[model samples]
Target: MVVAACAAALLAGLTGTAHAVDNLPPDQPLVEDLQSGGKPCATGDDTVYVPTPPRLSAVLYDPEEDNQPSESSPLSGEFEAWWTDADGTVQRRDYSTITLSSGSRQYWTMPSDLPADTVISWHVRANDGHATSPWSDDGNGSVCSFVYDDTNPEQPTISSPEYPTPDEVFWVDGVGVYGHFTVDSPSDDVVSYTYGFLGGPYGTVTAERPGAAVTIPYLPLTSGPKNLTVRAIDRSGRSSSQAQYDFNVKSGRAPVARWKLDDPAGSRSAAAETGTPARAGIGATFGGPAPTGTASTTTVALDGSGHGFLTPDTSATDIRDTFAVSAWVRPAETGRTMTVASQDAVGQPGFTLGLHAQESGALWSFAIGGARLSGGAPETGEWAHLLGLYDAETGKAHLYVNGHEVGDAVAATPAEAAGAFQIGRARGTTGYRDRWHGDVSDVQVHDRVVVPTEVSEHAWRKPTLLGHWSLSSATDGASPEQSGGTPLHLAGGASVYRASDDSCIPDIDPDCTYVPPPLVGDGHLALDGESGYASAEGPVVDTGDSFTIGVVVRLADSAPAHPMTVLSQAGEHTDAFKVRYDPPTNSWQLVMPERDEAGAPERVVSQITGADGGEGPGQRLVVVYDDGTDTIKLFLDGYTNADATASLPDGWHSSGALQIGRGTVGDGWGEYLHGDVDEVQAYAGALRDEDVLGLGGETNPCLC
Candidate 1:
C-alpha cells in the first residue's frame, strides 16, 4: 500500500516532473543516488538493521545535455524530503533542502527527538536551478520505508598496536602490519569488524564474529605509502568510531651531495661530492624565502628583475654526460618568466630548464631543452616537484613533475665538458636568459643516469642520491650538505625554518600529522561466473504472498550474449522458481516451473521485465510480485516501467533453500551468473519503490 501511495503521488506529479515512457524519462534533474551506511538495506527491502531515524544520503545529477551551461546556475539548490507521520498525515521534515551545486552527498536523518520503533515512510526530491525531478522513487515506485532500531551496541575498545604511536617509514616485510582488535557487547548477537587502508568504503572482512584477537591478513601491497583505519560493528548494524595508524613504505638510499640550505646570509654555495673544491656562489642577491611548517626546511625567493642565481664550481666528473636534476619549488606568483636551474656553456652544448605561464595567470607552461632535445611543461601549482634528466649514452632527455613523465623527449646534447652551473637564474650567455621569481628547496644532482623507477623512488627521497641540498638550517651564512662534503655560504640573508623535526616523520614531511589517514583501494568483490554462490534459508511465503527482489547487477559484456541466473531454488525439478536474465532482449524474468505429465519441468508463469538493457552501468533493477494484485512489475532505478498479470498461480509456495548467483536443476548446476551482482536482496513482503532508490549507490565506505 505504501508503494501504491508513492506511485500515485509520482504519477499525480507530487515530485513535480512527469514524462511518458515510450522511451526514457524526460531530461531533468534527479537524485542519481541515495543510500544508508554508504550501503543498501543489507537485511531486506523494508527493514535496515541499523539504528536511528536513520541517516539518508542523496546525490543529485543533472541531464548531461543541460550540465555545461553558458551562464553559471545557482551555486546551491533546494532538496525536499517529505514523509508520512504515525498519525496518518503527510508532513515535511525540518531538515534544510538547500545544498550547493558543488556540494556532495546531501544527507538527512530523523530528528533526535523522534521516538524509536516507529515505522517511517519518506520520499525525497531534488531541485536544480531549473526544475525539480519526479518525487524520488526507488525502481519500485515507492518511497523509502523502514522500522527504526535506535539502540546502538556497546562501544568497542581497540586493544592492539598501542595508541599515541608516532609515524614510521619502512618496507613491508613478508608479514604486513598487523592489527588485533576485540569488541564486547551485551547482546548475544555476534559482532563484525571492518578494516581498510586509508579512508575507506571497502571492508577487508564484511561480517566476521568478534574474537580475542582480530587481525587482517596480508595481501600484495601497493608501491607508495598508506595509512590503515578500522572500526567495529555489532549485530544491530551500529559501528564504532575508527582508530587510525599512519606509516609509509619508502626506499632507503644515501644521497650524493647534501645542502642543508639553512644558511641565513653572506655567501650562498652548493658543495661538490667527491670532495672536489668546486662549490656554488651567489650570482646576484638571493631572495624569496618559502616558509614550510612540516620539516621546517629553508626557502629563498628570487625576482625576475635581476639575474639572481648560484655560481657552481666546475668538476667534470660531477657534471658529466649523465645527469639527474631534482628540486622542490613553490611559485609565489604565476605567469611571469622564471628559470630555476641551468648549466649553459659558451656554446650550444648545455641545457636550460624553466617555467612558463599560459595565456592567463592561472595556467602553467613548463619546458626544458638542450641543443638537440626538450620536453614537458608542468601543471601550474603553488608547490610541485620538478625533475629533469639527460643521458648522453641513451641520447635522450626526459622531464617529469611529481614522478610522472611529461611529454615526448628527444636526444640530449652531451652535457659533459667543463661548464658553469647556475641556480634560480639561467646563464646570461644563452638567448633565453630568464631570472626566476619563486621559492626552491632540496636541489639534488646525480652524475649517473637514473631509470624511471629509480626516479619515482627518489620522489620519496630514495638512497644513493649523489648531490643533495636540503637547504635547511645554518648558524650564519655557512650551510653544509647533509653528507658534509660540499659546504656553501649564503650571501643575501634568507628566511627559513630553524626548528628540528622528529626523525620518525620520514620521507618528505609536507603535511605531517600525529595520526594520518589510511590509504584505501577499490573495494568491490569480483565473482567468477562458474563457482560463485551465497546461499541461505529464505523466509516462507505461501499461497497468499507478496515478494520483492531488488538487484544491482553489471552485465558480463557490452551486450550479454547468454542467459544468466540471479537467484533460484529447486527440489527434484518438481518444486522450483527462479529469476533469469536474457541477454538478447536485456530482459529479466521471474519464472516458475512445474513438472508436466512427460516428467519434465516446464515454464508455468513468468513475469518478463520490460526494463531496457545497457541503461549504462550500476543501475538498480527490481522485480516485484504482489499476490494482492496478482501481478509482477519491473522498476528501474526507481520508476515503474512495465507489469505482468498473474506472475504466480494459486498455491504458489516458495519455501526452500535460496541460492544466489546460480540455479540448480535436477541436482545439477546450470544458468550460472557472469559479471557482478551486488546488494542482491529479496523480501517476503512488498517493498516501496523509494526503498529501492536508497540501495542504488555502490558501497565503498573506506574510499579516501
Candidate 2:
C-alpha cells in the first residue's frame, strides 16, 4: 500500500520533538520514508495506517539566536546576520568567539583593539562530550558577531548645462549656477545639502546645507534647451539621491563696437576737454538781441551756433504751475528728432521728451500737459540717460530710461500747459521748430522730481564743474567777490548772502567798494510834502535772519488816507510788522507795531482788510518772514495765501533797510513809493515752502 503511505508521512514530521529517555551515543541513522517494500510499514492493506516514530529528543541550549545586542553606530558600519536553526548543528562551545580585523572586511577603525561596541558569540556543543542521545535533549548552539553601523558616503549628484535650443546663438548664459555640498558621517560624521530637481529648468534640492552640498553650475547657455538636477545629502539635513539632465543655449550679440573717428585735430582736443560754462543773470544784457520779443537762447556748443537752446515763458507761468526748466544737451547728430526737452504749445497740456518723428520713424517719446508716452526702443548714437517726470498729486507721468522704468502715464488730472518751453525748439507763436539736432551737455531744473538713480547716475557721470554763478555784466573778469549774484549754496548748513544794491562796490571803505543803497520806493516813511528827505528816513532794515521780499508796485497817483506801510521794526512800536494796502477796504493790511509811551511801538493793527480786486502799476508784492516763526505773511504774484497773525513776536532790532515803498521814519505822506520799484530781494531764511508755494527754487538756499 505504498508502504503505508510512506510511514504515514514520516510520522507527521515528528511534531515538535521533546526527548531525554536514555544515553545513546554512537548511533545516527534515521532516513525513512521510502516504501513499496522497504519494511517498517506493511501491516495494513492498500489503505494508510502507520504511526510510531518519536524517539531521540533533549537538546536544550535554545540560546535564542545568541542573546540579542545591536543598535549603535558611527565608525565604519555593517553587521547584520540571523539564524534560528535552518538545519541545526551550530557549535563553538565554551562562551564561543568569532572576531575579525585582518585587512578589515568592510571599513572600520574606531577605539581600536576590537573595541567600538564590539561583541561576538557562536557557542554550541551538541555531542562532543560523553553521550546523551536517546532523543538527546542536552545539546546547545548560538551565533552573534557585532559591528552595527552603516558607514557614510553620499553627497555627489549633479546633472547638466542644458537649455538654449532654437539653433542656439547667445543672449543669456548661466552666469549664476546654484551651489553647496559636503559628506563623511558614519563615523567621520559631516554631511549636508540637498535638492532634487525643482521644475525642469532646475529645482528641488532639500536639506538646505547642514554639513554642505548643493552646487549647480555648467552654464553655457544662449537662450535654449535646458534641464538640470541634483540631490543626495544627510547629517540631519537628510536627502537621498536624484540627479537629472538636459541643456543647450546660443543667441544675441553685436553691442560692443564703439566709434566716432575722423579727428578734426582730434575734435579740437575733444573740444577743449568738454567745455561748457557760461551762465548769466546778474544785471544780464550782454550786447545786442534779447528784448525784441522777450527771451530766447540756446548754447552749449560742439558747433551749431552754441547755446544749445532755451524758450521758457509760456505766457509767464503754466507748465502746470510752480514751474522749472533745465538744460545741457550733448549729441551733435545722434539718431535725429532731438529736441532735448520741449513744451509743445497749441492750447496747453505741457511736456515732450527727446527724439520723436512720425511716418513710423524715430523712437523715444514723452508728453504730459500735451499727452504722449511710449518708451522701450532707444539706443541711437549712445550717450543715453534721460528723465522727464511730472506729478500734480498722482496724475503720474514718467519716462526714465537709464534708471529703469521705461514708460508710464495716468491722468485724472495732468496735462495743463500754456506754450513757450523749448530747449532745442518747439515753442510757438509762429517760430522755432523742433530744432534739437545734437550735442547738449549738463541741464537741470527741479521744482521737484529728481529721484536719485545715484542722482541720475551723477547726472550723466561727471564732466566736472561744481560751482557757477550768473547775473552778468562781465565779472567773467573775475573778482567782484559778490556773494548774492546767485551764489547762496548753503543748502541746509546755513549762512546765506545777497544784501544787494551793488552789494559792496567802489568806496564803502575796506579798499573802496560798497554801493548798497538803491531801494528807493518809500525810503523809510515820513514824506509829507516830498523833497525826498524825511528827516533822514528812519526805519528800513534787515541785516540778516530769514527773509524774502520782492517789490514793484504802482498804486498811488493820489495817496494819503492811510494807503501805505511795509514795516518790519521789532523793538517797540507794538513790535512793528506790517504789510499794508487798504485804501478804505480795497483790501490788504497786516500792521501791528505800536508801544511808544516809553514802552516803544507807536502803532498796532495785526490783520484786517482783505479784498483783492486789482490795484495797478506792474503790481507785484511779496512778503515771507519765518524768523523761525512768530507769524507775518502775505503774497500776491508769488501765489497768494492771504490772512495771518499768530501773536507775531520775535527778538528784533537791526533797524536797517528792508522797509520799502513807504511806512516808517517821518512818515511824510508815504512818498516816493507811489510806484515803480524793480527786482529787490531779502532772502536770508524763510523762502522754501516750495519757494512759498509757487512750486520751485531751492537749488540750495539757507536761513539756518
Candidate 3:
C-alpha cells in the first residue's frame, strides 16, 4: 500500500513538470535563392553555359535565430538540394553542417558525373533538425536552370574578295597588299575570332552576337606566300579548330632598265636585259667576278681613270618625279668621292648614287641636287648593294645598303637632268669627276620609287653560299656539307649528337634564342679540348674578301686553363682568322694575324668582354669582315658588340684547310675548344647588321 502511494505521487510530479516545459517548434527556415558561379541562377527559359563544373550556392536565413537575443541562438544545421532534368529525372543531395549564423551563405559544386550540354533545374531548402524550409524558387514557384557546355565552338569560315582563291597568286598593286577578310562561325555560340598570319602574332576581333560575321583588314608588308589562320572562340572561352587560308602575293611593278653587265671580255657595249644598250668607255673592262658567283655572268671593272664609264641612251636621262637606282658595287678605293651612277645637271649632277667624302670618312651617299644624305661608312674592296630612291609624294630621298635602310630619309625634290645616264662617273663643276674605282654589276633603274620590300628583294638577290657545315648527321666520322661543299672530317673524339631540347621557333616557342636552320636538322658536333677537331679541304672561304662566318656554340667549361678556339682558317704559317674564347679576359675574340707569314709582330684581335662565355645555353657568334668599310665586327646573339669592333683594312688569303674546334698557333693547331658547335656558315659577302640579328633571332637573314 505504501509503494503504490509513492508511485502515484511521482506520476503527479512528472505530469506537472511536462505542463511547465516549452514545446514550440523553431520558426521555418527562410530559403532565399540559388546561385551558380557567384551569379544568380538563370530563370524562366534562359540557360547559362559554363566552362567547368558549375558551383551552386544560396543565401539562407532563420527567423528563429533572428528573434533570439543570444549570439549562440540555434540556426539551420543542414541543407537539401533537388535537381530535375529535362526528362523529369529527379536527383537529391544533402549537405550537413554545424549550426550556422542567422544569415549565412552556403555553396555546392556540381559533380563531374553531370551530363554536358544538358539543361537542368535545381533548387535548395534549409533544415534546422526540427523542421525544414520550403525549396527556393524564382519568386514564381519555378526552379532556376542552367546548361553544362564544355564543347568547343565550330571552325570559323574565312573569305576574302581580294584573295578569293587559296591556290591562286595575287599581284600587289602598290607598296603592300590589303585583304578584307570576313570571318563567320558555323556554331551560334561563337562570339569572337582569333586570327594571325603564320609565323606572326595573333589578334582578336569580337562579333556583335553569336553567329554574327566580323570583318578584319589585313595588310602584308612583304610579298610572298601567305597563310592566315582563324579560330572561333565562344563565350565559354573555348577555341575551335583553326581554319587556314593560303595565298600568294607578288610585286606588280617592274624596273624600267635592268643591266646585268654580263658582257664578255673585249665587248665594247653592255646590253640591257630590259631597256636600251649602253656603250662602255675607254677604260671599262669586262670579265670580273660577278655578285652572283656564277661563271656565266661577269662584272665590269673600272680603273677610276677618267674614261672608265658607261653611257646609256638619252632615254635613260628622263627623270623628273619619283625614281630609283640600284647597283652592286665593289669599291677598291676610299677616302674620296666615288660615283656608281649619275645624271648630269648644271653645276652638279641631278642625282648621284655613290660614296661621299666627309671629314669623318667616306660614307654611302645619295644626293638630289644639293641635298646629300649620307649613310654608314663605306668599306673599300667589299661588294655592297646600294639603292637610292626619290619619292615625290613624300619629297624625301632614301638610301639603302645591303637590303637595309641606312640613315633617316631626307626631304628633297628631284633635280632636273636631261643628259645621258652615266655609270661609274658623275659630272662635277669642271667636268666628269668622281669616277668609280672598282667593279659594278646588276644595275637597275626604276621609273617609280620602289617599295622597301622590293628594294630588299633586289638588294639581296642571292647570297653566295661559300660553305655550310650543318654538323647534324655524320657517318664514319665525316659530316656532310649542305651547300655542295667539302665534307668535314672529325678527328680525335669529336662526335655528332642530338640536341637535348627543341630549338627556339618564333611564334611557337616562348624563348627567343635563335638556332640556325642547319642546327634544327639532326644534331650538333661535340669536341674534347685535348684533340677533338674537324677539318675540311683547303680554302673553304676567301678570307681576303668581304665575308661572313658564324656558328652556334656552347662551352663545356666555364673557366678553362687555356683559350678555346671555335673556328679558324689556317694559312701556310698561321691562321688567317680565328673565332675563339679567351679565358684570361673572359671574352670572345676575333683574332687575325697582321700578316700571313710567321713571326708577325702584331695581331688584330677584337674581343667582346663581359659576355656569357661559360657553359651556358648556346649563343650565335658571328664575325663579319666588311672590306668595303674596312671594318671587322663581332656579334653575339644577333647584337653587335661595339666594344669589340675594329678597323681591319686588309686581310691575306688563307689557302690551308678550314679548321673547327681548334685554331692555328705559330705553325701548328692549338687552343682546341671543349664544347658543342653547330650551323657553321660562311658567306662570300659581308652580311648586314639586320642579317646578323636575323641569324640570331627568328628572322631568316637569307629570306629577308
lDDT of prediction 2: 0.36
C-alpha lDDT values of all predictions: 0.48, 0.36, 0.75
Clash count, one per candidate? 56, 117, 3
RMSD of each: 39.3, 28.9, 15.0
The TM-score that candidate 2 achieves is 0.23
Better of 1 and 2 by lDDT: 1
Instruction: Give per-residue CA lDDT, model 2, range 1-704, as digits (tens).
Output: 99998887766654323222222332211112112112221111221111111111111221222222541111111212222333453422122112221111121122222212112221122231334112211132112233222333354544222333234533333322221222222322234433332332444433343444344433222335444444444332334454444444333221111111112321221111121222221211122111111122322333323333443343323546423233333344545555666665564325656766656656566666546665544433234445666555345666665444464454524454555444455544565445665544334434433443333332332111112222122222221112433331111111111333233446454776532222232121112223221111233334223355544333434343546553333333333454566676655565554433234444433344433322232344555554423345666555554354333344255453234344554432242333323333444434534454431121223322
Q: Between the candidate structures 2 and 3, which one is better when assessed by lDDT?
A: 3
Quote model 3's TM-score. 0.53
| Ranking, lDDT, top scorer first | 3, 1, 2
The sequence of per-residue lDDT tens digits that candidate 3 reaches over residues 354-383 is 998988888888988457888766677667
Q: Which is the leading candidate under lDDT? A: 3
Query: How many angstroms is residue 201 displaced in model 2 relative to the true structure, after the best TM-score fit?
Result: 39
Off by over 4 Å in 2: 1-299, 302-338, 341-365, 368-387, 390-433, 437-561, 565-579, 586-686, 690-704
